[model samples]
Target chain A: MASKLGIIAGGGEFPGLVIAACRADGRPFHVLGLTGHADPKIIGDAPADWIRLGEAGTGFKLLKEAGVAEIVMIGPVRRPTLKELAPDWRTTKFFARVGLKALGDDGLLRAVAKEIESEGFTVVGIDSVLADCLAVAGPYGGLVPDDQAQSDILRAWEVAKGIGALDVGQAVVVQQGIVLGVEAVEGTDSLIRRCAELKREGPGGVLVKVRKPGQDRRLDLPTIGLATLREAAAAGLRGIVVQAGGALVLGREAIGAEADRLGLFVLGREDAC
Target chain B: MASKLGIIAGGGEFPGLVIAACRADGRPFHVLGLTGHADPKIIGDAPADWIRLGEAGTGFKLLKEAGVAEIVMIGPVRRPTLKELAPDWRTTKFFARVGLKALGDDGLLRAVAKEIESEGFTVVGIDSVLADCLAVAGPYGGLVPDDQAQSDILRAWEVAKGIGALDVGQAVVVQQGIVLGVEAVEGTDSLIRRCAELKREGPGGVLVKVRKPGQDRRLDLPTIGLATLREAAAAGLRGIVVQAGGALVLGREAIGAEADRLGLFVLGREDAC
Candidate 1:
């Protein structure tokens, strides 16, 4: 018998995809739907245990009852404010143990993954389950980048890396030779939207993404998908680039199809930025 | 006799303020307004000579004819594209001589200043004549930044300096401990506008601007004015901070008035960022 898998679902289609992948593989799984964050339709029909954020004690019990042997944390989870934490016994204890390291973004996540592991549930990266989701090197679309677009991508990559070293952001938009936008609190889609309004008249810009230098890939891996392609196309961008194998390309085939249809380029950079 | 002053008008109200200042002093002045830029009303009302950008030959001739001994370049000039340059023999020769060094923003401006000086007109810093236009140390609106806003400004100051080292931008917005937005090709007003949309629930963010580490002070000194106060207030920002005497404060009285009326703080940082 396949051991039941436990899923912690957040926003976006990622959780939904996880369910389908588990079902196709004949693996039974129970999802802990984070209230107000996970998609309503996806959590509504699934065998999900509704859990509020900051209720980790309750969440652990649900996973135990479901007899889950492994866990996957997937999708976009908006970081809550201090007041929003409203920690009960579990999350309060969780924070106490993490202590000062919780101040840094990566530090807190690392502690969370460590705390979950201490609870005896193996925390696995989503990519391990959905192997094909990792984007490959080279352009996904039939189209190739023009010289100017390629140059912009390279320029953006350099700037993005510098910002990453600061650990502030992962995406930047560059056109011709100048940077138009750098994503900080704003995510990639919004950054692309802002870039659209700022692009010069002659040609569109390039959206480039790379992992924050030395970032743990297991958590918060950079992702681009069909929606990314759609948004970039709508933004009148020439192309998109992400570090190959270091980022997730959700729905790769569909994204490639969309890219080709839109005459946009989706390039996967081969090495660390 | 008062030395004849030549005003090279760029794009913003700074040029207009200079003209008014000169008029008030009964200082004879001639304005060489860049054709596509500069406020039409202000330039039109003055003894102005119109010359397109890159037509430096005509500009030098006009200054000589006006008997101007020193010149002050003011206002916000959008950097022109290659095609827009359509370089007349003067600018074409200027770039050729500046050569590879003209690639960086500061380098190009420095070369331009040097080129103009070589033509025998002493290039004067705008601050030299408009000393009253410089923002002083301390708050203009009689309000101190609260603890949160103060911390955000300090945090933003650090990040802005890092970006400055890359010669990318000079301003950054920070709320809480996170950077909300960064300025690149997009100017301060737009960055503030973007920050307005990205700021989370809480007190608003702080805008921190400083001269880039090695930037030529005379060429593109950071600036703020009444419109800045209005827009920042409209965007729900708590305050703004800049390097004391290192940045131009156009229409200081009007900015102070608007800042006080809107309950926003305008600060001048004492230390180098």
Candidate 2:
């Protein structure tokens, strides 16, 4: 009998990738794909079950019925517009009992994770299954960051880490040692685009994205891919720095090739700050 | 003899309004109007001298020539785009030596003020000449915020202050205890517009603008006007809260009338935080 695993899929290609990895490793898995964010094609390709983004109650029931003991959560869930995702009676009652104060990304995710575990299923980080996908240090692709770019990266690294430590956001855009923009709700791509528009009068800047210090890795891990690189190029960004061993690199080879083609530097550095 | 004041004008009606207030009080003033940002019509009407934004070094020379001993900076100078204003050798040297440490608006303006004062002129806050323009605590318009909106304002007040303390920015948009957005370099109007877009998926929010705790009141006092209220309406915001006794209110009558017409609440609170 095959060893069974449960996958809690959010948005993006991460869930499908994980499913493929598991299949190649001969590990049987059932997926709980979110309705709006998850790709419908994933259901056909991966061994899985599916549910809507806010169908947490039903998701729990299906997982229990599958007799799943261990579960791995993966993919990006479209951050619910909190008002639209009014919790069902069960979730509302749970929240009422807990009376949480903060509702930041981490706080909400941790609460949701706890609720999942409270239902008697183990919540595992995706890294447990795809450790190989974690980004490595040093330059990626043919274009290595120059000395000046490296200095900017270091400066931005410290600033970004300070922001993260404050529990704000994990990404900042810098050029010539001046911050062009900081990420809040708009996400990285939008921030990068705004930086580009703001810097239209000067040379484009660098994007530094890292996992927040003490960030719970089970949910909302720092992620980048070919699309990210493409957006950065479109936004006239010179390069990007991702925290080594702290981010997931999707389509690594393609991202590398694109960065080289665009004369963009992609570097992964250890969390120095 | 009337008290002689020097006004450093940026864009908008701020400089004109300041001049009107001074004139009404029988205070004689000369204005150094920023070319790109200040309306030429207002400059012609105001009792002052004029200069281009890029002519900062020469602007000081003109100010000295005007026999200006006490100077008041007012209005919004278009933040110079990197390409548009190449700081002359003196300005370049100043920036190079200053380096990349974060300087909040007050710090930057104060440093600039000191640079001017070092050349033998006192840079004064607008309050020195037009104290009556400062906003007071109370409803300035017909629509008063209800208890629910007031609670949201209070919640946003804390968040906005925290953000301001970080020296990131001065405004935040919140609704029902959820922060929809925080301003950082993007400025308030754009921030509100973004929040409005997000509100399509969530509860319409309230905007909170406040002075940073320990902020140098001599410079960077938060200000709002008719355009701000119009922007808030465009962004679907229901109300606005500004720091009482710390905020400058320009076009008060027009702004008040517009806010009343739109049924938008405009409240000013003491900057206790």
Best by DockQ: 1
What TM-score does each of the candidates earn? 0.91, 0.90
Q: List, residue by residue over A1-273, the lDDT tens digit for candidate 1.
A: 657888999888888888998889988999999887899797657788988888999988999998888888888776665566678899999888776325325567777778788899988888877988887899897988888888788778888888887767889888766688888878899999888877776677889998888877777778888889889999999899999877888888898899999889998888643
Q: Chain A: TM-score in each candidate?
A: 0.95, 0.90
Backbone clashes (count) for model 1: 0
lDDT of 1: 0.82
Model 2 alpha-carbon drift over 4 Å, by segment: A1-3, A81-83, A100-105, A146-155, A162-168, B47-50, B81-83, B89-93, B96-106, B142-151, B200-202, B251-254
Model 1 per-residue lDDT at B183: 87
Per-residue accuracy of model 2 over B1-273 as CA lDDT, tens digit each: 645777888777677777788778887778887777778887776656666554677777877777778888887654555456666666665556654232323356667777778888887787777766677788878888877677778777876786666566678887655567777666788788777766645446798899877776667677888888999988888888889877887756776888899878888888664
Best by lDDT: 1
